[model samples]
Target chain A: MATFIGMPAFPEASARAVGDAQLRHNLRKATHTIRARRAAVVAEQPDWAGLRAAGAAIKDRTLRHLDVYLERLESAVTAAGGHVHWAEDAAEADRIVVDLVRATGETEVVKVKSMATQEIDLNAALAAAGIRAYETDLAELIVQLGDDLPSHILVPAIHRNRAEIREIFSGRMASWGRPAPEGLTDDPRALAEAARLHLRERFLRAKVGISGANFAVAETGTLVVLESEGNGRMCVTLPETLISVVGIEKIVPTWRDLEVFLQLLPRSSTGERMNPYTSMWTGATEGQEFHLVLVDNGRTSVLADRVGRQALRCIRCSACLNVCPVYERAGGHAYGSVYPGPIGAILTPQLRGLTGPLEESLPYASTLCGACYDVCPVAINIPEVLLDLRAKVVAGDHRAERLAMGAARRVLDHPKWLALAQRSVGRLRRWTPRHLPGPLSAWSDTREVPVPPRESFRDWWARRAGEEGGR
Target chain B: MSSRDRILARVRAALADVPRTETPEDVEVPRAYDRSRSGPDVVELLIDRLVDYRAVVREVTDVVAAVADALARRGAHRVAAPAGVPAAWLGGVQAVRDDPALSAADLDALDGVVTGCAVAVAETGTIVLDCAEDQGRRALTLIPDYHLCVVRRDRIVRTVPEALTRLDPSRPQTWISGPSATSDIELDRVEGVHGPRTLEVLITPAL
Candidate 1:
């Protein structure tokens, strides 16, 4: 799969989800627990708001001067004995990663869970080139064994529970060379153990490792991975060739900018002070070859937008996902793309563009609850960004959408016109059925349309203001 | 797109619409590091915070006995340490395992876990768990109840961002700012909800 770029629209994919009760149950339970924890811990610190502001500001400043900082980062990485490659998108990144692993003459590479690699569909690409890519991260391993795409950002397999996990591990782990023991149970600990035993073999044997960074330091040319598991350590060090794929947005201007994010990310995400594992590698070490692919893949297009540009600041901490009520109920798979949750809502549209069905519908996924913005470690105003994208989609081709807004503006510009509009709406409110006709019926299929008011709010407001004036 | 293509477009666009370069706008920031809140002070705060979370922090002069005593106190039956761990750090522990190749069964047999660090941050009162050297694999520290981490004072930094600067780009390095903890029941706090219950940090003045 070349990333789900050419997939059907989100509404089409979500229609499939409307019938699946299992996904809803898993998503609801997991998201609520994590959501409650994030709120409680976030409330502990009074400086959270300040920290968020600083994080947002720092990222804004860094992205503003990204050209200068990225060049500096490339130079710093090279001076540290690392090689840097610029990738336009998934294909370029895949080509570079495959070439690096091939140069080592190693057919097998162990991977640290990387969303960028997922964005490029790296494993499938590697398999096509006659190489095997093993996922060492526990959540990713389950996803790999199941031959399923990742539905969540932080926990890729959030859609699947322990029972589903056992089947994947027991049935498929061995075909990949590490089989689960017979009579595997659905206990998490047991499943984790099976994964551990299976992954340990590759960790000791792999000569190449692939990964993505949570943050990349421009001044130092350092790449950082904040994880709860130790598999990342096993894969990065054991491999002779370490290849890191990073988005241009992952950069922080300096160490000072890095601190604000580290605090904000952990607390908002796992509700911990810091992740259990934070890995940083500057370049090649002890005769290892280090290759960095700085992926642009629609990033420049995102950066070009005045409103949507804030998305490029994401650290991928997934704090927003843990907090989003919509994501909790709907689940990650409903979004039908790689980057799911709130980040996915805005980022997917910008990354791949709204050409596909899912892309156009993604910007509408949110309730604009503002919780995603509140918990965003980087302080991306998700609601504002979501609305901005909505305006782009609905009002798209300013000429076309402008026609609607213009008609709306004209009716609002005249009192008589407004009154006539109210009468028509009031009449329809009584006679019209709750469900609209045609594809528009999907809205009422899931929810009831509120009947229009007896009188326009403008008339009510004028009446109230007149009373106040008389007083 | 290649750098030339991207930058060339920017340059061409600048020829007409956007400024080639605007007057550099400098936003004012705090001039001085707050003396009351330094990296060392953050580390101190982190220690108090960790203690509040119920994990014990011990400042150690000799790491050998610190590791030995910590494990002895915890009554670890099977101990898993990072592969690059110095033999001296073991301090006569009979069952310590150094193989990165240890199966989960082998890891489970160990009474506890120990690992060396790539760096430590005093400001955050956190230890950087880079899977470097002897820091047994991340799971080694995570699966076991007692996490005995050896931190060198010099590795410590003042803030989370500063701490990130010291990390690598590729490998997974887990950051343990404090023992793992969570709270439920109207803000009733619980320790070791998922990860290590007892986090013993033996901070040494030097490696």
Candidate 2:
């Protein structure tokens, strides 16, 4: 619902980001630590490949018949005493959630760290409606307190170091609800304690909770959420009413499919044998009202493209982000979306449909190093989708590139034309400029032009043959 | 048409490539991953994994004595126990029972909670609670700062898949590994967050 409107394209944003020494240092340290942790845990599973394949296959099967699986999920959830709402887009989804919270007569709601809510900008929507939504996850809290946007999916404030976090907490925590303790330190443990004290009162008093699911089962009508802190548990459990906004692509056909994802996700996302907490609920627990909103916001369109549709198989592990060299240096903000990195390069363009310069440039954010594909738990071939998006961008725009390509194709089609052009270039080699004129100079700015030889290879070969015959 | 119908129609139109006759089972999902593990030392393995997550674990022959000793060591005076938990396990502490079902504020006021888990997984060193009578509601074990769970040796399974077979999907479940932790700050692990900061488990011999 909230677009990254007027944000500079990836190159411009990343150009500025690369010059920030503190930002680069923070990104390098965080990503390298997570990458090594993921590698170690992944190696422990001898059948990790099998599990990854199964995870991909399950998602594919569900996506192919998404209509059917969604129908089943709706019916099952209804039977289990939960209400389901269908949203055609972000505006519709936000309207549904705000209406639900309004019906409950609550002005404040506690939140779990959910990407779907972020994608739709739910908190901003609620704020506009005069309701406050508090983010409970540590990283999310840090981002919120600093008045900053999330950079990474798992750790939204990955760009901020411990000292900066301390500054944000000590300076901003009071305005939110609870103030920081007297003289808070930069040590992580102390920072966590301050958050615990601040949010504990809200958790005890909050009447409503909002979340996004890691996996939703069609067969059993279950929703699964994985997290490290007890904040997720408090939000989902202690509240009187719970609302979960989930993407339709998150559905799995059977309950047993969690075995594959519950293994692959933790190892891939946090590099843990298992995260500290995982909560599963079929429907409304005793004394709690439940609502499930199935959002088709830009997902059905993503499902339409055959090559681009694999992006739907993503579980939002952020493994691809951590392993991306381009992401490491350029940082997450440059991509200009709630989602970033290699996955974002392909996903954001498809979700938003190459709407502007920002969307068009996202597909070129990667170096096609294939590290993202190798680390992807669901095994989304990100580079393949990226190349597909790039081709589409070129076909849709770039008039000069199209003209140059057309001319090259015509010359390549005819041998005489190509040879004549080659000889003319060889004769005028000394007059060649190091950089091209006009818009073409953008390509040559960071590269050198090769000097042409005096003669063509074909002419040299023909002369040798004639001299041998003469001898 | 309703938004649901329109969205579903859009989905159907988008999936025009999928043959109409095709069923969900037409796609093959290869599940060759290890489903079950076998060995005699599963209890020992559970202890090793639980300790790896920084949970204090003890293999005790006497459940009652161990539970009491753990509470005493932590100096937990206002300990809470579910109605179904055996009274013998709480002899030494000021055992508060959830007979009327304590409120969130009430649970937060207590020092700790002791409950019996439904199942345990050795590979991940995780414990699951189904909110049965003995385990109480989700908030009982959550609101307090310290949690001491009793895991009978027989309930321990070798792998995650094996553990799933023994539980009911209909019941709300919470799977906990070690204490609450976060790696969000500079990607360094700092244990003890909103959940029980201290997790102590007593693995007793099966009845």
Candidate 3:
């Protein structure tokens, strides 16, 4: 019901989710299906481990020399007859995209599913600019028509069931492009048919198409997009003007580097050894013009950090999200950003900074279980990043947590001070309420803390030692 | 200043601030090793890998009979041939006429999806599906779960790098390793999650 659970902290958001039986059932089923298939296909290759290592190494090398590769990519694209644009942030990316659409004088466009656009909230911004962006991917169209935010990266509407989708299509599809047939049933095949018919018309009519690339080949100035649906291909080729917004991290050094990724991406993204529709476009074609926008919203900042930079290597494969226990339980909406799983857990905080309660709480969302890291095609050391971010949150940027950790550090720094603190706990234990007062109660709101022991463990240890000595 | 100018300036500044760390890093081309002797067997190796991925291999001595028999076995409801598919190769398939511009639903209804591949790699059991020269658009092999991909043995490469060399510098390319699948927590396997579940390869002998 909420656009995003952006306002609430984890406990609050999780409390709401745990109470929703339907949402839990949907997430449990979807996540389990994808997670199991990914492991099986991944294990089929004895070289999968080697492939993971190579993928991680390639991403590291590229990001480490991101400037050089991006420069090479830009020139290669321009030479191939494509135009390249640079955008600093979401607003700039949105503006550049809007201008590109406007220059063509197109009022509407068919869009391939692009996380970069969603990150910048391009659809909302475009709507405000009087340009309608039509989402061609079925799940994306569902979310767009229902005016919903994407919950998962790969399957954006992973949170919604077929019945909910049917309702959305039956009620909302008309105003968008083509309305659903009357008396649309809850069957998935029916909903898909409705979406296919609706999008096919737009594909034929639209003059411009919008997309985001999964990888950009520097050697050939090629942009790679992988999708299960054929909608992306229709949008990319049928339109006369193709404007693609790709993150700067998408660049790979050469066709050789691209080869590794083409192998790594499919396995990681949709649990496919090879994706159904893999769309790649270079400069302008026979009658089409191509514009590539390299977006660095907060990526450059992310790239500057040695420990946190690994997130830039992500191929946008939602495998990490599907396998994440936290994401499966809390759902993507709880992450408060377009990216709502393990990758989002690390990337979102860094991109937006640990500013609000939402961002700061993200780093602590995981139990450091390392499931995401194991599944990451690039092997981003997620646990290490989480601990590093937690340290930052508890030290400086997150002042409230900083103050608490500072007090704990001081009490533990001196023995007498610690004993005094432990003694006070023994006295306070008797009067300890079932819950803490006011805002502090957030900790005990959903979970209960065991009552403080009558005597500290250290005190008990000393007493046992003394009794033994007397005996 | 226009928004573009402001954005350019900011991007420039951001570039300036980021430390230049590209201190002569190697491209790790993989073929960077032998460097020279990578060309001859590339196509044969690509075919080897495609077959390794469980792609059904059938040599088309006669393009007409081969294409017809492949489609007939599947009892295809429809057949989407690449816009660039050779006239002779698609000359056969009687159940459904060779149509390049079928609807997505119509494409899905078909039992067979056929397209010519750009490159195939031997080491990784993967094939390159690019929109450069032969493959029309990227969707011909995507919508339907059964993909009957054609690979000229000359288009095959021994290593990933050699295959990369075969890809046209101008068109969009799709690299496919194998059929799509996923594994859940209890480790249950599911097929056809996204891509084609059945991959059939038509290995046309080198002319």
Decide which is better by lDDT, 1 or 3.
3
DockQ order of candidates, best first? 2, 3, 1
Top-TM-score structure, candidate number:
2
DockQ for all candidate structures vs. native: 0.22, 0.84, 0.23
Per residue, candidate 3 scores C-alpha lDDT tens digits across A243-292 of: 99999889877666766676677777766556645667777864579999
TM-score of 1: 0.81
At residue A126, candidate 3 shows an lDDT of: 86
iRMSD in angstroms, per model? 6.6, 0.7, 5.7
- What would the TM-scores of all predictions be? 0.81, 0.96, 0.83
lDDT by residue for model 2 (B1-207), tens: 998999999999999999999999998899989898566599998999899999999999988889889998998989889999988888878988998989888999999999999999998889999988879889999999999999998889988888888888899999999999998899889999899999999999997
The CAPRI class of candidate 1 is: incorrect
Candidate 1 lDDT over A326-375, as tens digits, reads 77766677787778888999999998887766777888888888988877
lDDT: which is higher, 1 or 2? 2
Task: State the number of backbone clashes in model 2.
Answer: 0
lDDT, candidates in the order shown = 0.72, 0.93, 0.74
Q: What shift in Å separates residue A460 of candidate 2 from its native position after superposition?
A: 8.4
